[model samples]
Target: MRTAYSVETVRAAERELIARLPEGALMQRAAAGLAAVCAGLLRKVYGARVVLLVGPGDNGGDALYAGARLARRGAGVTAVAMDPERIHEGGLRALLAAGGRLADGVPARADLVLDGLVGIGGRGGLRPAAAALVERIPAGAVVVAVDLPSGVDADTGEVAGAAVRADVTVTFGAYKPGLLIDPGASRAGAVRLVDIGLSLPEPEVEALQDAEVGALLPVPTASSDKYRRGVVGVVAGSAQYPGAAVLAVSGALRGGAGAVRYVGPAVDAVLARYPETLIGRGRVQAWVIGPGLGTGRAAEVAEVLADPVPVLVDADGLRGLDPAVLRGRPAPTLLTPHAGEAAALLGVSREEVEAARLTSVRALAAKYGAVALLKGSTTLVSAAGGPVRVNPTGTPWLATAGSGDVLSGLTGSLLAAGLDAVDAASVGAYLHGLAARRAASGAPLLAQHIAESLPEAWRQHP
Candidate 1:
């Protein structure tokens, strides 16, 4: 698992480590790692032009010291301080001694640019001076951000205003929530972790790696029959959008469920696509509701909610959800909603949900007393109280119309197969994303293509 700690936890760990080390030893260690990454990016350090956007804090110091290392390697390094008087004294001295000169403004051209204007402590967005420097970065330069991309909230991944769009981000010690979640994640091209030996605590956010996903996958053994493996009940689609039922069932069939029992108005459409589906609702380990289920189906949604089995709610089913009803449920409930649906449920604007994904997802989970999965460029799964799981695998091709319908079914199947709401949602997202990557292969893919590729995705992981 790739873990990310909050600013508070990281700072506490840094302070403790700094107390145990020499006055400037910790900063030097961070600078060394930062410089190594910079050097690697610029294969030949000699004669390369490096510009450092220096600020007043330790973040600027890390860049300054790293710039000194590059200067010593025969590279021309220039430091542009946001506040000349507030720059790190020791770092500035080191840079000057190593043949690096301080510049009043950004130069016309550069091979690389290091953003050291803000660190994990930063919130809201970049200051006017910092934003100005970021805007002046020379085109075509490989922008490498120190610690994290400036202007991104380290804890929430919220970008309030202008933020540095880096080609790569060299983070220290541990990852930050902002680096793994979007829109901060989109700004951060690729991330590289640099260990500074800060013994940290439990992370605030986590992304499951391939091995973790594989271990969580459920595989059938010899004594297992159709019922032993578990059955998934899908209630999706309507006369208006029968394709939704077909796509949902397609995903469920590939999701390790022994059998799928579907119930909805689009039964004929589902049978046409997947004749193996059980026609009516029966005993099921889990239920998947909504997804192309047009409006005015609240009673049907309530019926499923009353069942004593795990339920995954998406699309129209997410509409008008009663928090009290969900909270009183005996079995686990998973709510999957896109920004617009989430906004409607929370009574907030879609922009608000997108801008503050972490806060919105968490609020949804807490408010309903159920696990919540916020679908977007960066899919997030969060429960009432635990580290939020950030899905790492996905391509832009997944933004299709019925993509979410497929996801709802896949997750519901996992829930039926006995995975907890969180695990099912996470694993379902992982496979769904990988499947999309395989099916799309750089081209447009249909919702069914994603469903078709799930088996291949599952095989690769195993």
Candidate 2:
């Protein structure tokens, strides 16, 4: 699993390492890693022009020491100190000793820029000088952030003000929550972890690994039969939006469910796309309700939800769900909601949901007595009173329309295939993201194209 540590946890781990090691050891390790990454960013060490946006804290120390390494390697290195007086004395000496230049003004042209303006110790937005430096770096200059970009909240993933945008972010110790979440995550670009000998305990937040996903996937043995595997009944899409049914069914068919049973106005459309699907449901192991089913179609929604099987409620089903009905359900239920829908369910704004994604997903699970998957840049899945699973594999390209519908169907199908709610959500999200990444190849891709890439996603593992 790719585990992320909070700033507090990282500080604690840093402290532990500091106490045991000799002076400057940890910073040297961090600087070495940072310098190595800087070299990789340029793709060559010699004749490269590199600029360091230095601040006062140890963050600036990291950059200065790293710049000294680059300077010795034949890169033209310049340090633009935002806080000259508070800069790391030792680091500054090292840079000057290595023939690195100090410039009061920003460089007119540079191959790469290093953002050392802020680290986990920083709070709120960037100071004016740092912000100005961030703004001055023109396009085409690859920005590499040391620890984190200047104006991002290291703990909450919130960009309180103007933040430095990086092409690649090299973070120390462990992954920070900001690197995994949106807004801050959006600014983080591609993240790389550099271990600084800080041994941390169990992380509070984590992303699932391939082995974890493989273990969680619903795999049936030779002894398994259709009914033995599990049946997934879907109540999705109306005549008005039949595509939801088709897409949902497409994912369900790809998922491990033994059979997919459809019951909705879009039954004809579902049959047309997936002729193998059973048109009318008899018995179902799990139910996936919502998708394109309209908000006012609660009566039909309620009937399917009434079934004593694990249910995944998404899209329109999220609207107007009876709390009493949710409170009384015996079987497991999983609610998949994006920020907007989560906001509606929590009686808060979308910004509120985005601000506290981890808290929001878990709170929604507790409120509804169901597993909740808050879909976004970092899809969070939480079962009430259980460990939250954060999925970090999705591409921005997965933001295409109808993607959520496919995710809901796939998750519900996993549940039908006999995995628990938490497992189903995590596994489905991993597959959905892997498929999108495979399909997109860094280019724009449609939801259907993502759905079509499921086989390649499955083939990635044994």
Candidate 3:
């Protein structure tokens, strides 16, 4: 798993490592890794013009040292000091010794700009001087940030104000939450971590790796029969939007469920698409409700919820959810909701739900005594106990409509296949993102295309 730490956690780890190392050794390691990457970025390192946006802290120090390395390699490097008083004295001296020059503004058409304006310690947006320098950089110039971009919140992934939008970001130690989540993630064009020998604790957040997913996936053995493999029952779709049934069933079929028993008014439509699906729902290992089911379709949902099977709820099923309904339930329940739907349940605005996604999802799960999957760019899966799972594999292309419906089906299928609520949601999200990436492959793709690519994604796993 690719784990991400909060700014505080990373800083603590950095402090521990730095304390053990020789004075400036850790920074040198960071600089060396950064300089190598900068050299590889340019078409030709020899005589390429490079601009460094230098601030006051160690972040600026890293860039200056990197610039000195580039200068020695025949690159014309210039440093635009945002904080003249606080500049790294040792780094500046080293750069000057290596023939790197100091410039007031943007060099005449530089090949690349290194953003050393701020690091994880920065609180708000960039200062006016730093922001001005960032704005002065010409379009298409490859901007590389040291540690993190200037204006992004390292802990919460919130952009305080005007932030440096980098083409690439070279972060030190382990991954920061800002680099993996949105707003901040949008600013960090592409992220590369430079390990500085920090042994992090169990990460505050984690992104599932392919190997993790492969291991988590339900692979039936020779002794496993259809009944033992697991069965998933779906209570979704209404006459109004029967296509939702088709899409959800598509996701369920792609999951490792041995059999799917669908129960809803859209049963005919689902049967039309997936004829192999069991027609009527009797006893199932797991139950998935909502998706296309209208808010008015409470009767059908109540019937399923009465059963002892683990339940995965989504979409309209989120509306009018009585906390009492889930109280003391023998089986597990997973509730998946996008921000808008989550907002409804929380009695708050969608903006509020999104702004504090981690807190909101955890709150909902605890309130209902069920696992909650708050789906978005960084899909959050929180259980009733603790230790939330944050999904990291996703593209903006996955934001296309109908994706959530598919995710609900996939999560339900995983739950049916005998994974717990947390595992089901996390595994489902990982597969959903991988499928979308495979489907898009450099072009726009529809939701149906993403669902169709699940088999290809599974094949890539083992």
Candidate 4:
């Protein structure tokens, strides 16, 4: 699994490592790694033009030292200093000795631009000068950010103002929460971690890798029967949106559930698509409620909640949800809500929820006493108190309708298969996102396509 640390923890780790190493040794290690990546990106360092946007901190020093290395290799490297007085003395001297020159402004043309404008310590967004310089970067340039993109919160992934949009970001030590979550994740187009040998504690957030997912997936044994595998009950869809039932059932069928007992008004539509569906309520290991069951399905929701089985609530089911109903439940429960739904549940605007996704999801989980999955640019799963699981695999194409219903069904099946609410939600989101990426392949795709692609995704993971 790929893990992410909070800014405070990362800073402490870096400090501890720095203290253990010789003076300037840690910086040299960072610079060496940075320079190596730059060399690789440049292909032939000789005669290549590289621009370094140097700020007034250690990040700038790292870039300056890297520029010195590139200069020695015969590259025409220019360091655009954001603050001349505060430049690293050692780094500046090295660059000058290696024939690198300081420039007032960026050159007209350059193959690469290293954004060392701000480090993890930076707050809010880019300062005026930095933001102006970032805007001047040529479109063709491959912008590689140092540590992380400038103007992003290393801890929260929040971007208050203008930020560097890098083609790739080479981070040191370990991953930060910002690098895995968005809008910082999006700003950091592609992230590569450079080892700086800092021993750290448990991460603040985590993304499960394929190996972990494969191990967690419920596999059948030779002696296992249909009942033993697990049964998932889906209470979703309404007359208004019969397609939701079809899609939810579509996902449940592929969700490793031994049998799917669907109870809703869209029974005919679901049966037409998945003929093997058990048609009505039965003894199920878990229940997935509220996906297009428009209002008026309160009785169905109550019945599912009354049962001792694990339950997943989503979409229309989240509307006017009573937190009291979910308090101190015997069985585990998961709530899947998109930004709009989450905003309504929290009595806040969608923008507020989007701005603080981690907090909102955690708050929802605590308030309702269930695992909450906030679905958006970054699908986050949070329980009452623990590190949020940030899903890594996804595509913008998943914005299509009916996607949540499919995810609800998928996660509910995992819950039935004996995984807890946290694991169930996280794994389901990962596979669901992976399926969308596979199905879309950069083109428009319907929600059904994602459901259809789940088997391929499941097999690929295992």
Candidate 5:
């Protein structure tokens, strides 16, 4: 699992380590790690044109010390400090001694630009001076940020103002929550964690790695029969939109479910593509309700919720969701909602939910007392009183019709296969996104293509 800590946790860990180490030892360690990453990013360190954008505080000091290291190695390094008088004296002296000079203006073009303008302490947007310099950066110049991209909220992943967009971010000590969630995540192109020995407790957020997901995946043994593997029940699709049934069934078919029992009005539509589907409902371990069941299916929704099985409520089922009913379920309940559906459930605008995705996801989970997967640019799965799961794999091509329906089926199958609510949601989102990326390649792909690519996705497990 890829775990990320909040700014508060990171600071506490840093404080503990700094108190035990010699004066300036911790900063040096961070600077060294930062320099190593910078050196690797540059094709050849020697003669490389490196420009450091310096701000006040320890962030500027890190860049200055790192700049000094590169300058001593025969690279052309310059430090453009936003506040010259406030720069770290030790770091400034080190840079000057190593042949690095303070520049009056930004360089026209450089091999790389180190953004140390803002750190985790920064609140909103970039300062005018820093923003102006960032605007002039050459298009092709590789931008490497120290710790995190300037202007991003380290805790909330919110970009309130103009932020530096980095090609690669060399974060010190631990991963910040901002680095794992969007729109801050989008600004941080690629993240590299540099260990400085800051001991941290449980992370604020986590993204499952392939190895961890592989361990959680259920693979049957010789003793396992079809019934033993697990059976998933899908109740979806309306007469008006029978294709939803086909797409949902397609995803369930690929998921590791032993048998799929579907109950809906689109029986002919589902059977045409998936002949093996058992029509109507029998005993099931879990149920997926509403892909295109649409409105006016209150009784159907009620019937599924009454069953003592892990349930995934999605699409139309999420429209009139009552927290009381969900809390009453004997088994775990998973709620999958796109931004719009989530917004509806919370009685908020879609834009509001999108802007504060982290808060929105957590709120949804707490309110419903269930595992909530908020699907969007970044798929977030949150359980009540727990850190949200950030799905690392996905493509923009996944925003297609019936995509969520496919995800519902896949996740329902996992639930039936004995995964918990959180695991089923996170793992399902990860696989769903990966399959879409594989199916799309570089061009457009239909929702069916994503379903078709699941076996290939499973093959890609590390």
Candidate 6:
């Protein structure tokens, strides 16, 4: 599992490490790593043009020191400070000694540009001075951000205003939540971790790697039967959108569930698509409600909630949810909502939820006393407590009609197969995204394509 700590936690760790090390030693270690990455990106560091956007804090120092290293290797390096008086004296001296010069304005041509204007400590948006430097960056230059992209929140991944868009980000010590979640994640093109040797504590956010996800998957035993493997009950679709039921069942059948029992008015549509589906609910370990269910089905949603089994709610079922009723449930409940539905539940605007996805997901989880899965560019799974799991797999092509319905069924199947709320949601999202990437290699794909690719995604593991 990949873990990310808050800015506060990372600062504490950095301070402790700095106290024991010699003065300037910690900064030098960070600078060395930064320089190495830049060299690799340049391929031939000799005669390369490097521009460093220096700031008023340690981030600027890291860039200056790294620039000095490149200058020693015969690269023509230029440093542009946001404020000349506030620049780090030691770093500036080092760069000048190594043949690097201070530049009054951004050069028109450069092989690489280092965004050191702001680091993890900076908040809100960039000041006018820094934003101006960022705007002047030459096109086609490989922009590398030191630590994190400027104007992004290290803790929440929120971008209040103009932020740097980097081709690569070299983070030190630990990953920040902003690097893993959007819209900061989108700004951060690719991320590289540099170990500064700071011992850290539990992370506030985590992303499951492939191996971790494989371990969480349920494997049938030698003595297992259809019933033992688990059955998933799905209540979805209506006259208006019968395809939703077909798509949901398609995902459920491939989600490790031995059998799927479906209920609702779209019975004929589901049967015609999946003949193996058991019509009408019998005994099921979990239930998936909503998804093309249309409006005015609150009673059916309530009926499913009353059952003593895990339930995954999505789409139309997410409307007008009662927090107190969900909190009182005897079994686990997973709520999957896109930004719009999440906004409705939280009584906030969609723009607010999208801007602050981390906060919105956590708020939904705590308010309902259930696991909440916020689906978007970066899928997030969070419960009442514990670290929020960030899904690192997905393609922009996954954003399509009825795609969410497929996710709901897959997650419900995992819940039926005995995975806890968090694991079910996280693993489901991981596979769902991986499947989408496979299904839509670059072109547009239908919702059923994602469902069809689930088996191949599962085969990636043991």
lDDT of 4 by residue, 143-252 (tens): 99999999988988889899999988989889988988888999998888889998998888999989988888888889888799899999888889888888888888
- Candidates 1 and 5: which is better by TM-score? 1
TM-score of 1: 0.99
Instruction: List ranges where model 4 is wrong by over 4 Å.
Output: none
TM-score of model number 5:
0.98
Q: Per-residue lDDT tens digits of candidate 3, residues 41-84? A: 99589989899999999999999999999999999999999978
| Reference-based TM-score, model 4 | 0.98
Please, what's the RMSD in Å of model 2? 2.3
Per-residue lDDT of 435 in model 1: 95
* Residue pairs in clash, model 6: none
Candidate 1 residue pairs that clash: none
Which segments of model 6 are wrong by more than 4 Å?
Answer: none
Segments in model 5 whose C-alpha atoms lie over 4 Å from true places? none
Cα RMSD, each candidate: 0.8, 2.3, 2.0, 1.2, 1.2, 0.7
Q: Tell me the tens digit of each residue's lDDT in model 1 across 1-462.
A: 999999999999999999999999999999999999999999999999999999999999999999999999999999999999999999999999999999999998999999999988998899999999999999999999999999999998999999999999999999999999999999888999999998987788999999999998889999999899999999999989899999999999888889999998888888888899998979999999999999999999999999999999999998899999999999999999999999998999999999999999999999999999999999999999999999999899999989999999999999988899999999999999999999999999998899999999999878
Q: Cα miss at 431, model 1 (Å)? A: 0.7
> What TM-score would you give candidate 2 relative to the actual structure?
0.92
lDDT of 2 by residue, 367-421 (tens): 8888899999889888777457788788889998899888988888999998988
Better of 2 and 6 by TM-score: 6
Superposed by TM-score, candidate 6 places the C-alpha of residue 294 at a distance from the truth, in angstroms, of 0.9
- At residue 208, candidate 4 shows an lDDT of 94
* Pairs with steric clashes in candidate 3: none
Model 6 Cα shift for residue 331 (angstroms) = 1.1
Candidate 4 steric clashes: 0
Sorting all predicted structures by TM-score, with the top scorer first, yields: 6, 1, 5, 4, 3, 2
